[model samples]
Target: MKKVKKIIWLIGLIYVFCAMVNGDAVISSITTEAETTPIEDSASYLPDKEGKENKITDPNNMGDSKKEHLDSEISSGHIISQETLNKIYEQNGEKVAYLTFDDGPAPGVTPEILDILNREEIKATFFPIGENVKKYSDITKRIYEEGHDIGNHTYCHIYKEIYSSPESLINSLKKSDEILQAVLGERYHFNVMRFPGGSFGDKLAPFRKAVNEAGYSYIDWNCITGDGEVISAPTDRLIETLKKTSQGKEKLVILMHDSATKATTAEALPDIIQYLKDEGYSFKPLSQIEEGY
Candidate 1:
């Protein structure tokens, strides 16, 4: 009976030892699997060699920093007031320039300009012709989507038709404005107008009054690359013209065209931008000036 009892005790000891070994094996397998498994979902939470997780950059992934400034409550798609602008000039004396493009959304030239602008993170104003907007609506949409301001530059663009009289000019503006509204949808509103030639000329006085009274402002450029006047101007010539015309102006509204024929403008743009930078002038969209009113 003593031998039988010792045998039973030995069996119990063997059983306990086997169970302990199996339990350890199971735990080891689980730990190895956890270490080897690829964490596909989130790497940010997992421990690194330093035992610290990686920092998640841009959690919300709001890519555009411009959206914040444009969507701000203070100033959306409008310009700073002339008085405020003057005050800024008086205080800081920093040269400011508005880079205005007219007759744009052209096939090759417009997109190239947009790409350059995006790369540089600079903003400009586009005064798309109504006819061109209808033809290249997608590019027009791209212009606004990329945070540039748009103004009405008349639909027909025929000076004889659009510039016939005050009534004619107003009608042309409305037509152009409608096209912009249609393309941009209901939320987009542009209360700025640029005459077919300019806001000057005796023929535009009453038309200007009507537009101004109707809560629209007309803009005229003080400096130009003369791209419109000189169709085949070379890239260097365009840059030279820009530098020469904008030499002494403290506040300059530069008139540049983005028509298909104005490929030289796109070519000269980089140098022109650098010149502006070198001259201590900051680029601003027309909206900043328009909003102040």
Candidate 2:
């Protein structure tokens, strides 16, 4: 009996060892055995106000180290009032509705979404991943030429890899920036970019400082569609998710994903657009400002 129990324990140990080697274990379910070998990529070690690499990890935090501030380019320095958004404007100061897509230019999904936007006669924001930027060159040009805004979403989406160091963050930007500039040429201004994990990452302040010094605006999202949250969420579920989250917001800056083939965000796009339009929302691109730059 003792020998049989030992064999069973050895097999269980082997199964777990294999799972670790495969890098397939869920981060939240990390066990003592898992901790024996620290995950290959540790969490981002960003220095806070006092310059400590390791700080309290606040899961509830979206990762913004600093509060959102007004961009300096608005020389009047008028921080947009919540009251201003209650009203809608068209071709001018219409109610502010920003429909921004991130991690995109996917092979099938983006092209379809682009077609939909073209038909709708409305321009939206696209924050592209580096690989997608390189692979789907035509979509990038189409996005710009068709009057939609193109923003950056870094070269890769690896949070730990990008946020491990300040240098890594910039390097990731450079990687995507190079691809974009190469394909679109130097004149294709992509002054707007989004951090992969949004500004909530521990490195937001320092990272924004670096990008701002390079002449760019760091856009952090105020709302998300939840399309990136779960794969099995049906389109209605996706739409409901957005509706619930955006219920009280006046100028909703909706975050969406368009990169992965499996994300199903495009499937939710038409309904989302229709519902928002029916609800009296107007869409616009994120115009770049010089304040952060």
Candidate 3:
């Protein structure tokens, strides 16, 4: 009977040892799998300043050091008041030209434009549509790096969608700002914006108020290149339009497009810069004007 009890105890001990080894093996397999499995790239959905959530696709995976550097470069300039903006718009004093390009960061066009501006040693403002910013993030980054001011032109730039209501316009602006932050880092913010198709007339009155309330100062062009008036307008026509519209304007907010289709604008830019220089008008980024206020 004692021998039988001993045998049973030995059997129980072996069973317990085997169970312990099997448990360890299971845990080891699980840990290895966890380590080896690839994590899928998922959208980091985050809320914007307006408490609205937006899905930002971060292509660069910008590091903290780079972000800090960018933040350091950005200046927290004072927001221009309505009265000050009106004063600037009234063409009160200095003969300054604010060259603003809209609807871009185009693949071929924007880089070419940047090159021209670089050669001329002039800085301008670029109002890039959010969708374009995502598609051509590298160009967008280049614009910021090259010391140009950037403004939000809206996410999709669809007129009916954004113009349906004041709330709709505000939401679109917020979404565009989120997209800009995704590419340019969280510290970057555009205090100034230009409404698509110009923020003029009583139709946009509500939107104008909403935009100001949402912490943005909207700018309208007193002059245009008319590059967007026709599909791929001739370089001569663009130059002529600019000259005609800019006549008698001491302070010019010159509107132009830098979309891929508007290559002629790039071609005509050198002449435009020269013409402005000849006309005794100094080129300045829109931000510079705002900063004065």
Q: lDDT: which is higher, 2 or 3?
A: 3
What are the lDDT figures for the candidates, one per model?
A: 0.79, 0.71, 0.87
For residues 90-181, what per-residue lDDT tens digits would candidate 2 score against the true structure?
Answer: 13423456888888887778888888888888788889988888888988878877878777788987988988877888888888988987
Give candidate 2 misplaced runs (Cα > 4 Å): 1-94, 201-203, 288-293
**lDDT string, candidate 3, 197-284, tens digits:** 9899998999999999999988888889999888798899899999999999898989999988999999999999899999999988
Best by TM-score: 3
Candidate 3, residue 273: the lDDT equals 89
Q: Which parts of model 1 have CA positions greater than 4 angstroms off?
A: 1-92, 290-293
Quote each prediction's TM-score.
0.70, 0.64, 0.73
Model 1 residue 151 lDDT? 87
Estimate, for each residue in 1-293, the C-alpha lDDT of model 1 and write its tens digit.
99999999999999999999999999999999989977544223434579776643332344467345334632434533334433423323657888889988799999999998998888999999998999999999999889999988888889899767777878888888788878887557767778778878776778777767666777788898989897769998888888899877887889999988999899889899999998888888866653333
> Which residue pairs clash within candidate 1?
78-287, 78-291, 79-287, 79-288, 79-289, 79-290, 79-291, 79-292, 80-288, 81-292
lDDT of 2: 0.71
**What's the true lDDT of residue 184 in model 2?**
76
Cα lDDT for residue 263, candidate 1: 91
